[model samples]
Target: MSTWMVTGGAGYIGSHVVEAFRAQGIGVVVVDDLSSGHEAFVPADVPFVRTDVQDREAVAAALDEHRVQGVVHLAGFKYAGVSVTRPLHTYTQNVTGTVALLQAMADAGTTDIVFSSSAAVYGTPTVDLVTETTPTLPESPYGESKLVGEWLLRDQARALEGTSTPLRHTSLRYFNVVGSGHDHLYDTSPHNLFPLVLDALVQGRTPTVFGTDYPTPDGTCVRDYVHVADLATSHVAAARALEGGHDLAPVYNLGSGDGVSVRQIMSAVASVTGTPFTPQEAPRRPGDPARIVASGELAARDLDWQMRHTLEQMVESAWRARQAAEAATP
Candidate 1:
């Protein structure tokens, strides 16, 4: 089995990717700093390297020791709102870390990479349905850092053209990734909508829906929400595509063709958790887009991307995992 090094494999999304890869009989070695990831999230059998991705020597050593053939880069500061205040930290984690990882990959001669990018790169796009062709006008430093990571991959690939080992890479851009693939794994992002709402209910607080008077049909913001499992499978597919010598576009959007609104999500959560509570209405967050959904046609065609789970399924799985985590906590 070919080995792949997942940079943030202990993370919510990365852990799911690790699970998916292992399910396909692929070898996975995880390198995580545990900044926002729990060591328990990584399977006991997998080789776990507890170090920051920015540490070039450590990452390179992990790659060499594991005989890793490819890399799944997911480590970064992902909170967009907090990134506005902590721009330097976001850049260092996402941008500098990516550069270090790429350098390590070059040193190790491991070229294939699958990057975990975000829909934030579009930055409140005017287009109703965002495509890869949409301009990347990243608003927050976090988004900018992600875009820069993509640029680094592109430039590195170009620089390696015609080499014996050309860089092979593709970045997956996604919006509002939610749900859990395993009962043991759950989204822990304090800024994500699903986790925030789940946390509110777990803490006996009413979840707030900011600005419900959006121009959408339900008067709430409509955004793409793909299940974490579905997203993970696509990442594995991308890696396989690269390994198989298939040419892929530089970026692909893993999105729901048409998305669920915030109100619909709240309704699903209420139904799943068996707790019916009207969400508190709050003022519109400045710079919050009214609606931003993307077409997954590119990824669907190339990477087997699809919304395999319904909104209710996403909520149910997430609630179950959250409950499991709470039960296990002291």
Candidate 2:
């Protein structure tokens, strides 16, 4: 069996990607520093290396030792609002870490990779539906770092062109990824919407909506929310395509074409959790966009992308996993 290394395999999305790879009968090596990732998320059967991705020598050694054929890179500082205050930390983790990871891949002769990029690369796009061709003008340090990661992949591939082991890569620009692929692996980000609301509910507090006067249909900011499981499936597909020698676009947007309002999400959470409480509305935050959705046509064509779960299902899955995680916490 061919083995691949997952840089953030112990993280929420990265763990789900690891599960997807295992489901498909592929060998996986997990590497995570556990700064934001949980040590318990990695399976006992999979070989795991706990280290910072910026440690190129450590990562390269793991790859060489495991005979890794490819990599799925998802390790980074992911909070956008926090990134503003911690710009240096964000760049060091996302940008510099990616550079080191690429060097490690080169050292280990791992030619194929799937980069976990973000929709923030669009930086509040003016278009109704963002596509692969959308102009990238990142607004935050986190978004800028993700965009730089994609550029590194592209430039590295070009630099290795005609070489015996040229880099094969693609960046998956993900939108608001929510929900859970397994009962054991749930999103733990304190900054994300689902978790914030869920945590508030868990604490017997009402969840508050930051803004309620946006130009969206429901007067709330609209976003494209994709289920993490479905997103994970596409990562595996991307890895498969790269290794199969299929031509793919340099970047693909993993998103839902239809946008959902924050109010709608709150309603779904209420309905799914059977907790009826109106969300406290507040003034719009700075830089919040009215509507941000993307077209997944390109990903669908190449990566088998599709919206596999409904809004209610997304909320329900996330809530269940959150409860599971809470119960497991000692």
Candidate 3:
């Protein structure tokens, strides 16, 4: 079995990717700083290195020790709004950290990688359905950092081109990842809508909806809310494709061709949690786009991407995992 290193394998999405890799009979080694990832989330059998991706030496050592053939790079500062104020931190974590990882990979001779990119790369896109060809006009520093990371990969591939073993890489862009793949693994992002709403409901507080007067059918923001498990499957697929020397595009969007509105999400949450509290209404957030959905045609063609879970399934699975996490918390 080939071993792949997951940079943030202890976090929610990373943990799911680790699980998916394992299910495919692929070995996985995890390197995480525990900044936002929990050690418990990593399986006991998997080797876990407690270090940040910025620590080039540690990452390289882990790669060498594990005989890692490739990497699923997922560690970074992911909050777009926070990145606006903490641009330096975001750049350091996302851009500089990626640079260090790439350098380490080059030094250790591990070339294949599947980057955890984001739809933020196309900030407030004018097109209703974004494709891989959509022009990247990142708005926040976080989005900019992700775009820079993709550039780093492209440049590295170029630099290593025509070599005996050139770098092979692909980046997966996604939006609004929700739900839980494992009972112990749940989204812990304080800024994410699913977790925020679930956390509020768990704490007996009413959730708030930012806007309800968008140009959409329901007058609420519509987004491509793909389930985390479905997202993880694509990551594993990309890794396998790279391992098999299959050529892939530089980037692909793992998205729902159609999308769900915030109102629809709230209704699903209510039905799943058995909580019937009306969400508090608030003015639209500045720079908030009314609708942003991406077509997963490329991902489906290359990575076996599919929307296996319905909106209700996503909500219920997420709620169950949230409840499990809360119960486990001391």
Candidate 4:
């Protein structure tokens, strides 16, 4: 069996990927520091190392010890606003950490990688539906760091690939990742839109909606929200594609193929929670695009990717998980 190393496997999306891989009876070793990830999310049977991905030596040791054949690089700081506040930290975590991971992979003779990229790379796209050929003009450090990471992977792949060894990689660009598991592992980030709304609804407080008068159909910002499970499926598919000797570290967008306005999401949340909560409108957030939808054509054709979850399903699952989490709290 091919052993795999999943960085940030204890994180929200990473944990889902870990579960999916285990369900398929694939060997997986997780490396996480629990900074943004939760240890409780990590599976008990899978081998885990509590270490940073930037620690090259530690990562190398983990790779060698786990006999890793490939890596699903999912470790990175993803908060867009926070990245604006701490650009250096974002670069260090997203870019520098990836550099260290690639070096460690090279050292361990692990050549395959599937990177967890984001839609933030297409900052303020001029086109409504973003494609693989869309220009990458990231507005914040978070997106910039991911773009830089992609460049680094491409460069390293070019430098290392030959007859003896080959470096193959795939970067999956995920849109807004919503939804939660049955186990109640909700998102820890207070910055995410879904969690923020859920938290406010749980507290009987009004959720804040930024920019109500955008150019979108609902007069609010629109985004392509992809279910977390769909995103996780793309990751595994990307890994399997690379393991099959696919060359070039191509980028693929993961979205629902349709855009949902903020108002639509708010309505869905209210319907799911059975609460008539109104949103407090505010000025637009910096670096936020008016409307951002993606064409999942590449993902569909290449990885056989199709989102099985809808926005309603995502909202309902999130509400269920949030209620479960709150009920469990002391």
Candidate 5:
């Protein structure tokens, strides 16, 4: 079995990846400081180390001890608005943490990596579907940090001499990631729309729609929300490809293939739960794009990836998981 190290395996996306790997009978280890992620979310069988990715020594030791063949780096602050408000923290976590992780990987002879990037790097795209070749003009610190991380990975690979070991990296730029796990681990992100809507609905409250006068047909911000399970599968595929000697720094975009508006999301939730719902409209938030969908054709063709869940399936699954968690609570 191939051994892998997941940097933020306790977080939402990381945990999903961890479960996916374990389900495939692969050996996995996790390193997370639990600053934002929960320990309860991590699988019980997989080995875990509670430590910061910035701690070079700790990360290196984990890699070596686990004999990690590759890494999936997913630990970083992801809130776009918060990143704009706190640029320094965003840089430190996304950029500095990546540097530290790369150094540790180098020290441990772990050269293959699957990076978690974002479509925010595309900023305000002129077209509805953004291709990987689109100009990167990140509008927020979070986006800038991710783009810089991508550059760092490429540069690190390019700088390797013939005698030195090569670093192969795949950066998967994902749009908004949503949905819930079978275990129903409460994801702690206050920015993502899916969980926020689920939270508000469970409390018998009206969900907030930040922008209702957007240029889209629904008059609300539209985004491509890919299910977390499909996203996790993409990471697994990328890792396997790199391990099989794919001599390229493959960059792929993960999306739902279409856009979903805030109003439509509310409608989906209401339909799933069989409840009449209305959203509270608020002024448009900064950095809010009218529509942001990705061209996942490359990912599908190269990685053999396909989004299996429909929009209704995503909402219903999330609702079921959230309700189960609430019912299980004392």
Candidate 6:
């Protein structure tokens, strides 16, 4: 069986990608620093290396040991708002981390990579629906770092154009990734909207909606939320496409093209959790886009991407998982 290395595989999205790969009968070796990932999230049977992606020697060793065919790079600092306050940290984790991982791949002669990028690359987009052709105007250090990560992949590939081990790469720019494909694996992100709302309700606290003065119809931030599982499916597809010698766009947006506002998400949380409480409004957060929705036409055409889960389903599953997590907590 061909094994692939998944950086941040113990993380919420990375864990789901691990599961998706396992479901497809693919072998996986997980490498995570556990800074934000949970060791329990990884399956006991799968191989795991507890280290940061910046540890090029350790990552290269793992790749060689496991005979990894490719890599799904998802390990990095992901908080857009927090990145504004900690630019250096963001660049170190996202940019320097990517550089180290790419270096490790070169060492191990692993040529294929699927980068887990964010929609933040197209910061506060001007178009109604973002596409692959959209201009990249990163507003935060996190966004800028992700863009630089993509550039690294392209530049590395270009440098190895005539080499024995030519790099094959793709970056999947995800919008708001939510929902629980499995109740056992829910999002635990403190900065993410879904987890924040769910955590508030779980603790009998009112969920606070940050920024109600955005330039959207609801006067709140609008985002294109995609189910985490659906998003994971495309990561695997991208990996397979590269391994199969199939050409793909350097970047693909895994967006819904359907805008959902914070108020709407609050409403969904209220309805799904059977807790009808108005969310407390707050000032607009730093580095938050007023609205961002993107067309997944490119990914759908190439990587079998589609919105399989509805908004209602997303909230319901997340609530279910949150409850499960609470019950399991000591």
- Candidate maximizing TM-score: 6
Candidate 2 Cα misplacement greater than 4 A, ranges: 283-287
Q: Per-residue lDDT for 152 in model 3?
A: 97
For model 5, name the residue pairs that clash. Answer: none
Q: For candidate 1, write residues 258-322 as lDDT tens digits.
A: 87899999999999889999999988765467787999999999999989998889999999999
Every model's TM-score: 0.97, 0.97, 0.97, 0.97, 0.97, 0.99
Which pairs clash in the backbone of model 6? none
Tens-digit lDDT track of model 3 for 1-330: 899999999998999999999999999999899999999999999999999999999999888988899999999989887787899999999999999999899878897999999988898888989999999988888888999999999999999999876899999997989998788899989888899899999999999998889889988889999999999999999999999999999999999999889988999999888899899998876545677899999999999999999999999899999999889989
What ranges in model 4 sit over 4 Å off?
247-249
How accurate locally is residue 133 in candidate 6, as Cα lDDT from 0 to 100? 95
- Expressed as tens digits, the lDDT of each residue in 256-299 for candidate 4 is 77999898999999888889877899998776878889999888
Scanning candidate 6 in windows of ten residues, the lowest lDDT window is 181-190
lDDT for predicted candidate 3 compared with the true structure: 0.92
* Model 5 Cα lDDT, one tens digit per residue, 246-329: 754358888767888889888988888888877888898776667888878889977767888888988877877788888988
lDDT of 2 by residue, 1-330 (tens): 889899999999999999999999999999999999998999999999999999999999999999998999999999887888899999999999999999999998899999999888888888999999989988888899999999999999999999988999999998899999899999899888999999999999999998887777889989999999999999999999999999999999998999998999998999889899999987865445677799999999999999999998899899999999789879
Q: Which stretches of candidate 5 lie over 4 Å from their true place?
A: none
Query: lDDT of each prediction vs. the true structure?
Result: 0.93, 0.93, 0.92, 0.86, 0.86, 0.95
Best by lDDT: 6
TM-score between candidate 1 and the true structure? 0.97
What is the alpha-carbon lDDT for the whole of candidate 4? 0.86
